[model samples]
Target: MGQAGGGASQAQEPTGLNKLQHIRRRCTCLLPLAGWLMTCAVHAQSAPTQSDFGGAGLLQTPTARMADEGEVAFTASRTSPYTRYNFTLQPLPWLESAFRYLNIANVPYGIVPNSNSQSYKDKSIDVKVRLWPETHYLPAFSVGIRDLGGTGLFSSEYVVGNKRFGSMDASLGLAWGYMGNRGDIANPLDVLSDKFKIRPGGFSGTGGNFNTSHYFRGRPAFFGGISYQTAWQPLILKLEYEGNNYKHEPFKNNQPQRTPINVGAVYRLNRGVDLSLALERGRVAMFGFTLHTNLAESPGPTKLLDPPPPVRTQTPPTQTPQQVDWSAVSTELRSNAGIEVSKITRRGREVLVTGEQQRYFYPAKALGRTARVLDNQLGADIDWYTVVATREGMPIVATSVHRQRFDDLLDYNIDLSTFRRSVEQDTPLPQREEVLYRATPKKFDGGFSLGFSESLGGPDAFVLYQVSADYDANYHFTPNLWWSGGFSANLLNNYDKFKYDAPSNLPRVRTYVREYLTSSRITMPTFQLTTSRQLGTDLYGLAYAGMLESMYGGVGGEVLYRPMGERWAIGADVNWVKQRGFDQDFSFRQYHVATGQVTGYFNLGYKDVTLALSAGRYLAGDWGTTIDVSREFRNGVRMGAYATFTNVSAAQFGEGSFDKGIYISIPFDLMLPSSHVRSANIMWQPLLRDGGARLNKRYTLYDLTSDRDSDLFQDNLQQITE
Candidate 1:
């Protein structure tokens, strides 16, 4: 007996000092992996630096290099009379786009008719595309247009090439327009057309139209630069020879230049920030900083707040359905699996769970965790687990998984492909099963948020902003019905400075923004009763009534037909809305219109690009079509641009000519410690006009039925265990 006891003690798992030694061994094995990851991080930081004008470049000139796809950066720079604020996004590996607001300190916004003498501001868009990547003996080449859609003041186009040798990077380019003011060489495209020799004079009409006629016109100039990365990882030194002389500056505001040579230095403040200082034209001192992050590479922080999956040492003895405590199992599903259990039922050897996932972004992960919870609570007779994922009260999809296959996957006895083969997704069955438990949902939901509104490049000021405290609430009448409302109180604002009103030939549907901002200290932005229903196997319907937005109040309904697991969907909406008074009260204005749209959404399946086309009637009673294109990143960051063209002419639409804007949506889970399905949206509209204005509906059927799509689950299958 003593000899047997010694053998058992020796065979026991490691503990105390033995456990420490075992941990040390495992850590030792991971050393190489950790070193490799660290090396990769160091290499990632060596990517092309963002220039003062934004995008990958040196100083004011661009390079052929591109930032990683899905990277976003905000850059601000000041050089004497010009202060530039630029927002850039790399939507594709070979494409970079930038939107900029140029503030000229020396120029007045306008004369008497304008509200104030605030510095003149001009907005411009730029785009660059890579022609080819660099090889061992060749340089990377790219073509680009600067100040694409705006006044032709700083308009220019160029083709650039970049080559890297060890720590040194070199770039060379030929530019026209503002950058080619030197007029060193005759227009290269003059052979194709004499129009390329003499660029059009003066500004574009009202400013938003793409003046493609001015592109690549006039004489060209040569520009080149070299940037050296020093031994110190945080610093880079630059030297550039600019193509433009300062004589042809915007508004004929000439500047003196002693030399075309420009020298600069960029210092890394941290992983996501860079500070740069430059001496351009040998006459002006410039400073800028860039804040950037790779949305595709950012996985966010670990979810420390999430509950861990239950671990089983060995398969527990199965109990019969009658012997199980269904209430306890439901509670565990809610707490551990992030599922709001509506009801639990059983059919033969399968357990059916009908619920909504309120906490997880991916339903597959929620379903995976649900299976683990059921495996621990249910009887051995259960060979299958089916979860009916619901939105509101409508069943959206039913995913069924084989219990044995799932277990085999967890145990590494079967691969994901093998396990996936055992899983099935389809519409929920119409038949009823024996109910084991049903839950009662809470009745009220509400929250407070800090609200901010801003109007940029306005004549009254460079930026007019309002800060408000918003309180929103929802009362659930039933599983599928809710009454929602929100109110805002002025916390702090500079709306008193909002005195300018944009003139519109069409009905003043949207240009009345100035009045709305200055007339109210407290406002009710929304008060609506909303409900949804599943109309068919792949169709959903939504209806809402009451105050739809701060400026409009009425009723609207939307219907969407989205086949499950498909890449395309179509939706239509119609609304009858009346303009609200400037005070944001219940009083209505004389303007009322019926507006509707038939929108088609297509997922191109290339780089996760999505296109949306809407043919609709605007708030101003004009007919038009809106084109919206967007791309999604791996970490749920989405960037999109949209433009609206209506029957109203450009002159009738006022300053911006038409309506256009860009938006970025970032998932909250990417910034917070907890898991979340909600995202924060940031939108930038160059100008708000009366043309092509659509009603800001509170909800849409497509968004509500997002969980019905299976692409998100399939793309993130590995996260199931997590």
Candidate 2:
């Protein structure tokens, strides 16, 4: 089996440290597999880490076993001509996905070299799904596709099974394509179709196609491996039989195969790291390492602050609403929840506090905490505390809570049904004399940010990276009206190597990517005026004008209708813009266009899953629908996949057979809750073609007004008192 990029893995929840004693006290059937943490003498200790190759396997091939859900790993391993850096993520117990960078040291970057004979790097994708779970009598089984989408230099398909007995795990499988180049066995599915009798030579010279027609259509071979735990924990011995003879390596260079048997050893250095060494072909020596973590769980930021105003044991003294020291309450709100109070008013027995959310990710925590503040400052006579959660100074939801019941609810003393009955959620109308305190909106605010833009796997360069620093600010004229802008300067990049452009017959909508990156060190990607307002109880409206992004300048508007506490929402957006000149300096290109979309979103109600679909005209006049599916973990990590299919034919779409990519978003709050305000996102697309490109707009109302969804409150219910 071919494997690369291996290091270490450590996965523990924030409170996992306290469970070590318990884990050491008992041993179970799965104990042997996790006994790496302790010496063989103390076999009860479970190692909180997992090792992998090809995303979810031991070496070159996949196994029925899957990584723990939400586990993420990065691997870098090498043998000789082939070195790979791969990213693996497990979002579900039955699914595994990975994106890889395969470097062939023997292959030149291009026919015409820039200097020395450099290696060729290819990007590829792999996915595996379990078909059956391992039981007392049966092995776990799974089906997978490797190097299926991208340059198909190492493409193949396989079905594998895995089983664990005592201190040993064994796997066996059948493969095709690059995995079965030896042709050890005749075509197995030839009876189904004559096409299955022969395999194609190679994929289209121009890559980036989700070509499924070639799957399982070739000679098959057998591959198997067995790993055993040694007397010492953390040291496992492995032996395997390879299916491919390496007769057809990349770049047309065939490799020698001395034998089919491979022997290896894996050593655990620490909880988060592992070291491996192996003998391949009885000639090549290989070594590597891995680094991994559990995205599903992590320790909460450990910083000290005012303890959430101790959940009072007894009710405090009463006070007139006018005498409730407003300034002191404002300071408490900012210190505990990062909420900026805009206005506070009292109407008889109920008090209304309106504010903008700036810090706490859960508005429920903010809402619940404010109620506690009122409970301590006012008497029991004051029956209600209402919060008008605002976004950009506009009211989104007016949530009312019964002060007495809120305390019981937050303390986990009451059921959701009983607690929900004590609260009322509504959309507020105009008011006259109720406001007792009003905060003058800040006219200007700004901050600093850092980001990177990168592209990989082109004939010109293996990897192109651009790191930039940005300055962004927003000017508030009214609560609902504002102007925002940002300018970024490139601090480092390898754009100088971006000399060659792939052949394309379509419009140059995205072909000038290099020109824009090299044009200037500083660029104004955005400068715009925006306004938001509630059109009705469940409908919202937004309008914006000016430079929307580095690629386009436009004026746009959007309208959305999302019910108060529902799983579905629909919206529409329209824009008109001209391409920005390479200089990114106020000059526009001759190319211009108008585009828009009618979008719909649905909550799948399974493990934070959501589906979104959009149909519209694209930037290059192509009409299409883009479908996106994503799942957000409770810890704020989001993994998603998207595909856009348009009227444009495959040939016209250029290098990419169609538009598709996978993305992951990491929320900073998971690392530094007190300091985080936004999440960071990374996208990996096979190719940026013109067929399904869209203007990169800066803002959207749906994201801005998200608290309107009922699930938002349920997701964070346990954090109410924190």
Candidate 3:
């Protein structure tokens, strides 16, 4: 026995050690995972944390916390390389204030000096207050002020809005700001005496003490607008008018004041993001991002007081001690039966009327009781004639006659009861059957396109052909969010044959420039993760981050506000994009610009025809520092005219002078039904030159090519060309 016990003890020793080793390995593997899960749990819990009422209530409507209800919320966002901080406070149920700050350090600087200047800073501060809550016939109202502080200039605006119908909201507002206008004079001698003029107040007759002095003033401006919102999608349409007038003292020139009418539309691509286009004096396009925080909880429905209970009473028997009919008791009973029957009939009618009145007054509580009484009364009237019969010697007979003249009364009640039952059961016949119509989903939206663009009087002109195919799919992972992706490929061919005559008056020769004839094919595969939410009836906001090929990555946000019933809307957006290049052969570099735009749109209807106008400005970018206007027909089909005017200098080939132009474009959409194909649009743009000394003198062929020749010959050539 001792020997066996010794062997067993030895066997159990290794088993114990093996078990310990297994447990240790498991702990080693699971420790880090558990820690990671705990970290994630903490972040998830902390990220969307909310305060109740007065910093202690659950966050509800993002705008609510901004209004008074003693609710306050804080939300933060990061789009790597940029971080934003948002804070909201609610002092009243109808009032709110939101503050936002955005900072980016990797903003791109382009080839031009000011095109991508390091000092290109952008910032805005806005405050909004609700004026009135919604009413049955009146719209909700609100007012706001926006202060835009940026690199070049600063401006402020006051805005007002009204909610219309049950789901639409509209707004109108005015703004005024000062823009610095500096002149470029090659020779100061032209404006100075002996190149050193010192006027009484200053060298330039301005009230400054120095020669190189600065003059500044704020120009008065005003604008009015209206807008609408819809629920089908986050769609906002807006229309407005903006104008300003100013004068330059030293130049003694009056700037052409603009009274630009504008229209625009914005569709939320997702929560925190949107796509927008507008036309004013020129065309403005924008992609933006937005962040929202609920400041208070939305109020629940109002409560109503309960109705008073009904009073109850008993009626004493009306019949009193009267003459006894003992001799003919049976006959008397029969005669009296008729009076009883009549009394029952009158009581039943009174009961029905009382029940109906109760139902009308307290529908919820009385409906069931009324139904039960009606059923009981109906049953009593139907069976009132029931009686027992005795068989006579030869045949069945009414032995005692039952002495109940109430039989006729019962029969009459039964007949009336049947009629009433039929009447009650009969309802209005349905005129039509209900139908459910479902929209069919499209799978592919792909096509090839061709386009031609030219400058009427510039050295560059091109006829381009492009073949492209696109596919877009939206997958819903939840009720309020979707994941969308699209792919497209485009091939471009440029024709650049030019005919020019030599200065010696030789015959014109046709030559093709290699740089102009270069063709490129670009394939863009795009993907996006988006989330969207409805603000109220017609207001919504979206935020999105997307990638287009390996070169372009973008993040932005947008907001749309549409009043319930109108066809106008207002939208605003802010966005940032970073585009990288792969190589010289495939790279086209542009300045990294952060832009904000506020647009308004109007839809004028005439039978089947609709006309639209849009206007807005690119608030931060140097490329589109102008007002854009366009008139669209048939929802972007057919021909439309557009114009763009800018104060920024043009591209180098145009001698870097300020540029402006108007053009007419014809757009056609081709739709096919065989595949998942939606539609494709082809646009043809014919240039229209603006007639002005500045534009005409800026890029004259002689001026561009003049440095290669003598001044006298250049002037002669310029005269001949003109």
Candidate 4:
């Protein structure tokens, strides 16, 4: 990271002249080529390594495991040398994305009067879709796109790789991009009249013009590399070669640009933790640390069985040894032949009773039936036995029998009140009342922001103003989902004016009429019920639907991936908005718009010298797009540049007329000592050229965290959820 020091000086100027002069004095050479060579050299030397300041996690393990049996991994770094930190989240098995913030500290203010006042602004976001996974010798592949904020469209790589051999793995990649026809010029004349054209000897309409489109078309770039991961060690080494070709009129000088070779290494400590370092000339030596936590672990594993052990038992015993009945004892000695039977033994003697009739003896049979009944009720097999002895001390006889049955014996008479009480006591109780207090006033969470821009080029200078805002909130009536509501508004106003000088030194015809001053705005209020489920660690999939403006509503879904670390996030939303048109000329249209954004932020250094950047791009209806980059310096100093482009071909706006412009601003924090005070920032915004009428720059001071009564503060307070 670069240190913050000194005001605007000769050393800070970005020019080929200074670079050439420095090189010529040191080594005999012209400056432009030398500067280009120096840039490449710097890039080569400062290439990312596992141990560089922000190169951590260069060779980390896969973020998520495969449900089937395959592995996928992805890693990325910012393209600019000034970038300080980059991070990504890949919670889903198939998707990957990242966000990066570059540190361009101390961009000089007052460069073009009101134009260069903004301070500290840098940001970028990237998203990649894996198209194929490696199988055997085949390599994995992916298609990705990056939004460098104001820098324009950056396509991503299609990677192919081979299995690691010893300490080495080889890979190849290809990328392509179409740079948006957008840029800022130091001098307005370069983009104005033919006299100031870039090609001095060329005919009319040969060079720069504000209205003339400079589409870059699509340009392909290629890169290849060989990386080595040492066996049984934590070290990984890599070398890469990359080049690109731009096929566009605006970037004619950058055709066949060859990037310097990069060399770096990564060190891994565990599955989701690693350290990295990298170096590139003119860029800072970067070092970074990364730790990934799986969200799948949050909910824990699932259980397949409920109400565990069922009750059952063996049959009960049915019989026991018995003695003969006294009344029947006299009949047991009789034989079937009608003769009286008599027996005598040493252990027993025959029994005789008066007035007894002769009868044969038979064992009692009721014991067996009782035993069978007991076995059937108890679901168990049981044995029954019976024994009889004579009254005169004769020997006894015994018999045993077994019984079995299949039946439920145990009664399920559980106490419901007792079970309910146990559950109520064990489960955690939710907070009945939550104290809500204001934690210092904050900026607006959602509101309309109006901005105006002027075109300094051409015989005509034009001014444009834009207003955009969105209101969103959620109410949780249940623990699982929420009632979501949102409102959006957008407006744009454009005015054109121009003045030219004639050849005779007299004032040329001045056209002051507003050539095509138009404005359009839309207001939409929506209500939806949303429910989301965890798809991975820090990742979720949500579906929602409800009435919109009391007219129409349609179902939609979205996927959001937030890495364990808060530095980066990516999401995709698809909605089918339906509305019936009004009977009059101004009627509503039913349509659907898909939108997605990847966002991220990171600190460049420690303490008062730190720099931070945040970047993002939004894709919406009719290919409408917005890019923002912001950088902040220590002591609350910040600078930012933003560009918004819209191709409203599908809307009422025709193809020939579209809206596009850029806004740059610098803001500084002014702290004061007071009990109810926090901090405040002052912003400087200048209109480059306002419809042939240039106005003085404007400076505004506002509370950093707005006061309770402030519009920003009220908006944020209402957005708060309990």
Candidate 5:
């Protein structure tokens, strides 16, 4: 017994010392390189540097600096243990947020063998708030947290700063948790609590908590670095020293470091692209690149449009003229206002223009502009301009504006605060023989789009991608109701490599993605006839049926109450869906469920912050609540994060602990010279767990009537001057 005990003790010591623990926490690749190029974490109220991201120093470390407003950055870098993809955005001068996917190459997400040797991709969120702005005499400073959720692999906190002098930038900071493993220092947080004296090895609870007790405790450490601009302005040299000794690196793998100093250099490859290489820990060779742009400053080719009739300022003509050329007026409406008039009639002193809105995103702006077009053409006898907007054949609310008030508001001759109160809604009058002008309604419209489709962070495969082409079309039956559909054909894909059923206790509602990706070479992702209406002043309703998404066919209806020019709204939605077959064609699966939600939306109106919350029964039969908050920028770039918690415990939900994600939604018009009504939403969810999953409803009333809030018009009032 003594001999066996001696052997066990000897074997257990090394195993405990070198245990790899990142798989349970969150995973991170500490692959920063040669010269420490710790630039500002967020780009706001500042200019970018060579080390905007992925520089010669610690890749994950950040400095007390910021990018200019509306800056968006994409970064990719790699080391032995982890390859990281980072999407960073600067919403304000003092705040920065980022979404990270750390592809841990060494560990398999699942235990059993699969054809694809995929890595465990863990998702993380990062944020840095500037405590003080940089000045010529003082260094800028910031505080930040990493891996606030998802496994806690690389969870850490730090306070850092940056100072610039001529051609060189210097950064320094103190770190705790995963970062403070190097130089042992006094535990400053120990004064607050004895429990904080020694850091806990593994988190006892699920991820996403603040983990405040462990912060700034344990062994503290100091890390700092510097970068120098060389004689060649395009070349930057880097040098950095870190506090981490790598003695307790998660997973029992203590990377050996021959020297404490790291060195590297960066070469500017192009205007907004950078290439970096570094010698890390005097051993590993690290490399990566970054693509960055300031959306507010992007010099994309402008979309040309005919200027609005040179902002006509002429007085209205005075006459009850029957000989006026109405055909010319219709042509002008199409070119300038994008309104297809079904009919125009005069009832007393009011002129009613009935048709579908074709161009503008909201009827308010379109009405305001169309009012100017009429003012230039109509006789001064017309006093009231009534616009009856419709989507299908059904009528939305009719907005009537006193002609003089509309002109004054358009020309800035009247204050918006007062002119807004002058508009009123009236019930639509019946069509009569008095119809003076009429035009044929457009029945059909279509467009073609092609792009690469991809899914990431799945157990079946870290990533799966396909080149796809989609032919999209819409048939307008009247004005407000339309049938929309898209046919997609796969040009190329490697989804055949996918084959795995992740071990889980919950129902495999999402694990069949691989089968779907492989089975469908050509698919109809969406085919639905949607009808919508403004039910009342603040109430709206919509109903849709047919294939809603790639994986489900459903019929659903939604109702919402959103007051005009208000910052908060409440809504409800319900759907009954039948699972679609793996082929993605019009077929059915055995699984089906009814799902719904009572949701609330609040625009905090502080730095463009918006909060969205929902409670309901999910598609997987789990009851839960979801909270989503976002920050939007002046340039229309939005970055946000969301979390969903169901009654199902972490053990039942499996790997990700819970459902969470980060997203960035950006308007395409921000980069183009002229605006288009298109925005791209990119989401990064860690796992496809069957918990807290909602039905993919095609349309939500809140998204459709976004114009009811006055912010959009107020923010871009210059567009109305035309």
Candidate 6:
């Protein structure tokens, strides 16, 4: 990642400038290519439909069509001996990715010797990218890989093209691997290298490796399909030619293929759901359903529970400062404007309010409402209003507004553009001024909520889940100092089925998950004391100690340098920790290790994408680098994926060659009828091993000081008027 200005420069070496220049030159050269593609891009008549394999396609074969960006879908289908559960996402306009779990009904899991337990479950990932958009005379083209970085059972590589004519969409492609088992066509790449004709076979070691060397090798076949929209608006019909004849299947459980034709129909139940049925191999019947939504542009539930912004008065105020009810103004700021007031001070013609925003996700909304409350309460003598926004005890950003200009905009005398020019934002600094009102801060806060945990794809059972009632409490000794703790009581659970514990060659820092999950009915996951400070204008610091997470108790500290208005930030953290007992109480285990990392964050200007790169020593005493990439939708939903590559060999890391996962964050306001700044996060990790694990820190300076960024306000500017 290229470093931005200010504090980010310190994290870069001298060679950074040359690399940045090279990147700029490369981007400049690609501009014309991008423009050409845009000029030729075809507009879709309707939204793309999901295929049985959980992507944009027809029946059994994929197409070159792309789904709208930010689309998320879950698909489940059962076809005779095979059952599939798939999660698919469109994070970019030209990219589609899916994670799938295929269950073989006839095959045992095979992991537990001498035991007929769960059915065989295989996990795989697929990715597709559009190479060319369809134009008036051209067809759209796409290249993709199926079952990437997994066992070679279902692996395939294909290049496909699609063209639309009236209500029909046609697609064709050449396939390899399982899909090309028919060998109807010779390998085209054999001319480039003889090795392409000699394909390696079988699963290597424990699986999960990319096995890139085997991709696009062996004999090939051809597949084509067409999808037609019927006169009935809610129905579509599909016909496809199969690529594989089913001569070979995983686990030597092949089935006879009477024919290579598949037919299917899809019925749209509603805008968000679809039901599908199909017949494949001229014998098997298939049925499935899909649930999908566009997260990028979907307007969430209306906020009926929130208070309306303070009303603007038609006439100017006439009351003097002393006659004004300052107490009432403070109360109004908290209740209506969502600001927790610390003090109200007057400096000549300006009134400065030091407070923290607790309710609204966007700072502009709070500022707009604050202006209305002050304009309705104070006299005309107060010409300016400034807010010193604080998080803990430390001030972060100071925003000032011209009182008359704001009122003019609200009253329709001036436009938003004119009023926006009169606003000023800068870093906050301490100042001595006349204090009008200093309120005492509330000290205690607590809440109760429900929690859930689950483990999937294990050999012991398909899924082991738990539901719990959780209690969390916080006691603030000062604005920056506090103690926090949480406890959970099991409401319901089937964790008794969690009987497998995979052995690790290392210190077993994380593989003890089974023991932790089944250890106790009531557990205290965290109990910690933490304090924070604004060390400098652009630097922040935090330190914590005690039971930091369910499996570890530790002392740790972090320092972050994030310059205001910059697109980048850098931070570092280190922890000295000891493993917690399986009971998740105050007891400790004998194993101990020191882990630390230096991480850099970069916000790429395209599609709200951001990248985080970290190099560190992990819990198992292994060293590695982790890369995280994420994008935030317009509606405040964020989706991201991360991967870690350690110095340990693939065999040492076991099942999954490395560690990787994906996560989604949904803002609470999207579901609740009230304004909320917090979000709920859901993460999926395929397999948890002993490598590339870091401390699950409860607090990070970047998240704590999020309000300091101007982008949050600009991105949600619509809230300014509401």
lDDT of 5 at 573: 89
Clashing pairs in 6: none
Looking at candidate 6, what is the lDDT of residue 695? 77
The 10-residue segment with the lowest total lDDT in model 4: 15-24
User: Which scores higher on TM-score, 2 or 4?
Assistant: 2
Error of 5 at 461 (Å): 4.8
Name the regions of candidate 1 deviating beyond 4 angstroms.
1-44, 111-117, 313-317, 415-418
Where does the lowest 10-residue lDDT sum fall in candidate 1? 1-10
Q: Write the per-residue lDDT of candidate 4 for residues 644-682, one digit (tens) a residue.
A: 344432122211122222111111011111111111121
lDDT of 6 by residue, 1-722 (tens): 11100000001111111010111112222223233222222222255777767788877788999888877777889987989888788888899888888888998887766436678877777889999899999899999998888777788888899999999999989988887788887899999999899678887545568888888899989998999999998899999997998878888889888899999998977676778999999999989987777766655567799998888777878986667788889999999989999999888888988998889876878888998888887887899999889877878888898998887777789877777788888888766788888888879889886665556777776776556678888998999999988887878777666556666677888777667766897888889999999999999999999998878998999999988878888999999999999998999999999998898988898877878899999999999999888877766767777788999888888877787666555565655568876654545566777888777776777777666667666677556667
Write down the TM-score for model 5. Answer: 0.81
lDDT tens digits, residue span 1-722, model 5? 00000000000000011111111011001111001113322232234542322211244456777777666667788766767777777767787777677676776654446623666556667778889988878898899877666456677778888888888889999888777787467877778878767876774333544566566667778888887888986677788877677777655657787876778877766556667788877888778777666654432343475344436645657656355567777777766676677777788777777776666543455677677777776787789887776545544446787888777776679977678678775445455535768877677888776645455665555556656677778897855678987887778776675555555677666656556666877888779889887677667888899988767888999898977657798999888988898888889999888888898888997977888898998878889998888776554556666788999888887666677665555454433344445454445555566777666554566655554555554554444444
The model with the greater lDDT, 1 or 5, is 1
Show where candidate 6 strays beyond 4 Å.
Answer: 1-45, 320-323, 412-420
RMSD of each: 12.8, 8.1, 34.7, 31.0, 10.1, 8.8
User: How many clashing residue pairs appear in each of the predictions shown?
Assistant: 0, 13, 71, 41, 33, 0
TM-score of 3: 0.27
Pairs of colliding residues, candidate 1:
none
**Which ranges of candidate 3 are over 4 A from the true structure?**
1-462, 468-480, 483-522, 548-552, 582-591, 604-620, 623-639, 649-722
The global C-alpha lDDT for each of the candidates, from Candidate 1 onward, is 0.77, 0.70, 0.27, 0.29, 0.64, 0.77
